[model samples]
Target: MKNRTKIALLLLSSFGLMACDVATNTSPKTDPNTTAQTAVVSEASSSDNVTKEKVETTKAEVVMKAKTTSDGKLILGEQEWVYIPGLKESFKARVDTGATTSSVSAVDIQPFERDGEDWVKFKIEHDGINSDEIELPVERWVKIRQSSAEGTQRRAVVVAWLQMGDYKAQTEFTLADRTHLTFPILLGRSFVNGVAVVDVSQKYIQDKHKE
Candidate 1:
């Protein structure tokens, strides 16, 4: 009887060891529904990021389309009519973005003194026609390098009031001989920096200014 009891206890211990080993080796089952939900959430987050990028790109495009600023400025073309209040005349102007300062056609440019201040006398000459003699105090002088001529030429700069369409402002112009050029007035970046915008494809976008 003692031997039979000992054998039964050994069998019971073996059965418990086998059950514990099976539990340790088995892996927990994953729920298919929960996995599907997680994938959907990740996809949605990626889509939202893409949408935000598109919104930022659209705002930049809008600013580019609205070329004009809040102040009274104009969208100028490759060529426009510019009126000079000092000369009381208007001339065809070429809008050149490459030039740093504006220039006007002048001839017989001579520097003099008035009231102990430096002054200059010159006449606008273009297409072989000479204008009336005009005198003004020289604001400054600038040296320009000519592509066709040797060395740099010294030009006299003067302040002048300009009118184009509805926009009007006082800007500096370097007096030079532009008789050989097609346009007498060459509008440069200084004049159009804050006053106008240039569109190279179009020409004569603004109407001729009237008195």
Candidate 2:
């Protein structure tokens, strides 16, 4: 009878051990998406303002093929002309990735002083489509570059504040006749510096239909 009792106790202990093993061996149950989201949040928190300031780009070198302006105008890499919403028309323009100043075609360039400050008054046919009337603005002119244009063709231009797709930049444009050119707006290297990167292979990535 003692031997039977010992056998019975051993069996009970063995069963208890098996039960403990079963409890500890249970698999972890958690949502995969939740786990991934947590990891993403952690990574974002760890990184500095660099992650928060600009649009998140892929790990692989991201080339901005196309982008839209703050005014919702679509633009492409190295696109020559951009539609001005205010004018409701397209102008002849060029994208000069090397030029540091934005050049606009202007004619009848004149300068004057207003309110005891230097200002310029020039006329440009707003958008080559709708209005025939010229856009005349008298704004303060700051000479940032003396020899901005190509070689001996240096131009004196006025600086204006420009907004492109949540990016604001001051660009210098000259009043010159660019009517002969295919595009009226010349986006110089200066304008493209920080706001854009040129993909020489890609053109008109934004609006395919635009000329």
| TM-score of each model, in listed order | 0.64, 0.47
Cα-based lDDT at residue 87, candidate 2? 46
Global fold similarity of model 2 (TM-score): 0.47
Q: Which 10 successive residues of model 1 have the least lDDT summed?
A: 63-72
lDDT tens digits, residue span 1-211, model 2: 9999999999999999999999999997899999999999988886755764454564322545336545544444566345554445555455776765567666665666666765555556433543333433444343443464654543456665544444445666665556666666778766665556655565655442232
Error of 2 at 195 (Å): 1.0
Q: Give the Å shift of residue 38 in candidate 2.
A: 46
Clashes of each: 0, 14
Q: Which stretches of candidate 1 lie over 4 Å from their true place?
A: 1-71
Q: Over the full model, what C-alpha lDDT does candidate 1 score relative to the true structure?
A: 0.87
lDDT minimum window of 10 residues, candidate 2 = 126-135
Candidate 1, residues 1-211, lDDT tens digits: the string is 9999999999999999999999999998999999999999999999999998999899978655444546757878899898887777889999998999999999999999999988899999876557899898999988888798899988889988888876678998899988888999999999988778888987887778787
